[model samples]
Target: MSDRAETSERTTMAPRASELGDFLRARRAALRPEDVGLTPYGERRRVPGLRREELCLLAGVSVTHYTRLEQGRGTRVSREVLTAIARALRLDEDEISHLMDLAAPARRPAQPRPEHAGDSARQLINAMAQVPALILDRRNDVLAWNGLGHALLGGHLDPGDPDLPAHRPNLTRMLFLEEHMRDLYGEHWPEEATLAVASLRLTAGRNPDDRRLAELVGRLAVQSGEFAERWARHPVRTCTSGTKRMDHPVVGRLELAFETLQIPKSPGQRLIAYSAAPGSPSERALRDLLPQGRPDAEERPRAVLSAVASRG
Candidate 1:
């Protein structure tokens, strides 16, 4: 597929008010009155969980106002009001951001897509070859990766076609939908899922109009019940640095530290590098699994150029 076509298919679309309302209602419905310290009365209520009035009471907002907000009638919600709702709903930082995003969307005509890495960013990734490094766009599309970078993560996929949405191996989708991902990560699926959802939640809040991102969220919501459930809870988080244990097919059980460096030129793009302490079993495993020769010089230059170009 052409670059634009691939991008359009993979990126999330903007969220509509109705979509936002339904999401809110679903989440609200999942909570019981007692969850928020509200008394349950009128047991014959038609709804399965807390009623709008009960939610409002717990949230310390008027029933009518909360209802209007849930019904997509209320606009211009104050930050304090949003925080109250978040607390009542037992939302995390991620979910709170989502609520705010739904309440106040970014003005149409998104800020210009940031410039991709310049030569400097390329050098950075290249210099860290021993450390598995890859660059990803705002929507989490894999923009570029060094050879070792490819082997460490998605060596099975066509790295050249990383930009194509269909071919794009979204970290979340792979975690839940791809059998290889389950096999590769073994029991770390839950941790991976939480991080992915949290990251997506953060992105949604920052760039709600991103059509491709919206589509991704919608697709995952439909395909994976677990994803849908967590997404509705509106959890948000940023994954900058973390420790991950991976059961690699070739490298065996490997525990590594990872750091995400945001490319200065690319507003939403980040370069992630994975490392293991020297002489550790995981580090030795990685070295043994990776090719022994000096890294291919030809592809290095192209990878650097691609990383920079993707920002544009």
Candidate 2:
């Protein structure tokens, strides 16, 4: 199969409002009447969670209004209404933001604009000899990576692949489609995969018309049953920093704390850098993976030039 896999036949080119409805339904189904202090009578409930009537009662909206919203009808969806519904559902801050994104009017579909790591970003990653760092677009495409970053995360792939748009390594695809990534996470694979899906859902809400992203999501959904199931749950969240446990082939078991630094000029581009705690086994393992000496700008891969060129 080609790298840009065709979207599954079952996947529809549905409107964003449809997504909003799906999210609401999923969240509503997951919420119990008892969650919001609504006493359930001693009887078998016909459906899971709170019924529409109960939810609307709690949200302070008429059943008709709530039903219309859940049905994705063309009624004016006000922020106040969403806030009320969000409160009724007990959504967290990230979920609240995701709800707003899904409810926003869809933008006109456009061609996928090329994304690349700028020279400054490349230089920044290269300078971090001890830290494993890589630049990623909103779609989780690896635009560029320092030697240590490539060695630590994707030693199985071609080192120069990230420089070419067509061949660039996407972290999301690797997590689900590639066995090496799954092996790296080992016991923590489920947590890692869930977080990846949740992060992608957040991005999808923000850029509903991003065709490439849609393609990525559809391909994963069709190819990986695990991904399809989690996606159906409508998980949404923002993850800026976290700890990753990995069973590296060369460095053995390592626990690394990671941080994401957003590039202001490139809206969705961010530099993800990983570091181990001081005087720890992970630090020593990380140091073993680093190159003998800091690589100067001249030593950086030629792939970066191709990436920079592709941006224009």
Candidate 3:
């Protein structure tokens, strides 16, 4: 609640309009004239890529309108115009979705916070105790994590506290800025960085009005040059299932397969469970560490889930 007071004083911050413009422009420039079926002009152009008129012709928008949009002068672009621009630039679904978010109108006002997790969510986490399980909000906050979860992923934090975001141990920030994280994961930082940036990109597409999420990303970009580089590449990926390698101080090397399960009716919350193959050293180590076939359960207050209609 005290944290809420601090957060409330800094609410309603809007995303940077120039940043959005730069993003759109960069994506447009990446497309070659030949790739889009346009003939290369005879002379070298001053700009690195496509001219504004060329993109407008490809996207079927007026030169003035497209120029205005790219310059961040237009604020009321319709979905039709956005779709046209996306098609002209040959954007995939994810890129198109990001474009839509960039073009969306600003949110009106703050609404009540949504329910973070329910009894069912808690039960699911309890059931997966033998497996490292964590519940995260869209911004990658550690909302609720079981004992094995904390032990396996981040041993520095307490699993019993839901307000851990105050310490700001975001997975993205840890992977990039924290030396402990680099030592813990070592060679796997690239994989982890890709997934973290990809997840953040997906969340941005889904919740453009989430000011806290925006702030967290801005901070990460400023603090970590690696993150800024990866983000600039415009790499997008979905994290549904993957294999993660970790060097746990207590358990040594672990090759664990992870599955991300979306919480039913919880739009942005996901339960990530990690498990090693049976009879493997990692699995055996996990079982040996767990006592008498009992899994550890730590209870804490859930996150504040906003009441936005589910867009999933």
Candidate 4:
């Protein structure tokens, strides 16, 4: 594709300051005056939440300065100023980190690099034979998945799909665009959908230079109105661990607690493993999903599956 055409399709190609401004505006609009301990004097309010002037006063910044920052004209923002604004906005740690990223995104290579699960990461997931585990990139592209992971989350897909760079199943895409995945979450789909979008929002802010990630957002926004709506809300969060309620086609309903462990030295790459509480029905169902002849519980498997191979 031509450079201009490609750039046009990328959602992150917009100026960083503009994104920062939009995020600030959204967060500012969501907060009411009383929420921040400011008694409303009621001067015929027009805006939803704290006005730019009110926020500037609360943040200890001048109206013109805050206005410049909000209007995408402020290129150089200090950490102190950002911290002050974050406090006034009542932003949590994740949101503060997001603000910092928007103000000063880490420089990345202009080229998009191929993402692959390392040999050790694959070995680690396979070692946890009893657990359902998958390795995903910042964009939530499934780089690799153990057999149980495939069985639990994507039995309908080809087991080797993750090995293909061009065809890697993106979790966020499947959540909104794929029917089988939507069916897996059942009635709790909306909650899962929201969390997925919120998590993606953080990734989008942190990796503004990622063209593929930008294209993913653009495609989802165009194809899924629900995704577009949530994206517009600008939800930002870090879900390192959580419980997922799912209705598996094979195992039925399961309340599985999942943990996301970041791979050392690999930014945005993490291993997500899911398990149920001991003696619970969910645990029993999980056990049933394990591969047959998995060496006795006390013993490790003789070898890992070929599906977990590293890139050549």
Q: Largest lDDT belongs to which candidate? A: 2
Q: How would you encode candidate 3's per-residue C-alpha lDDT over 1-312 as one tens digit per residue?
A: 443332322222434354457667878778888988999889978886678888889888999887777777886888998889889888888778777776777664344353345567767776776888888777777667666777776777655445433553567777888887887787887878887897787677567667677667767666676776666665555778989887777767888899988886788788888899988998987765453433335333332222122332
Off by over 4 Å in 2: 1-12, 292-300, 303-312
- Cα lDDT of model 4 by residue, 162-224, tens digit: 877777899999999999988999999999999999899898888888888888888887778
What is the per-residue lDDT of model 1 for residues 165-269, given as tens digits with 9 covering 90 to 100?
446556777777787877877788787888888788778767766656677776777677677666655556878998988888777898989999877676778
Candidate ranking (lDDT, best to worst):
2, 4, 1, 3
Backbone clashes under 3 angstroms, per model: 15, 0, 2, 0
Clashes of 4: 0
> Which RMSD does model 1 reach against the true structure?
5.6
lDDT of candidates 1 onward, in order: 0.71, 0.85, 0.70, 0.84
Cα TM-score per model: 0.78, 0.93, 0.80, 0.89
By TM-score, the better pick of 2 and 4 is: 2
Q: Tell me the lDDT of candidate 2.
A: 0.85
Model 3 CA deviation exceeding 4 Å by range: 1-19, 109-116, 163-165, 232-234, 279-282, 288-296, 299-312
- Candidate 3: residue 119 lDDT (0-100): 64
Per-residue accuracy of model 2 over 85-193 as CA lDDT, tens digit each: 9999999999999999988877887899767787888889988978999999999999989888998988887777787778899999999999999999999999999
Candidate 1 Cα lDDT to native: 0.71
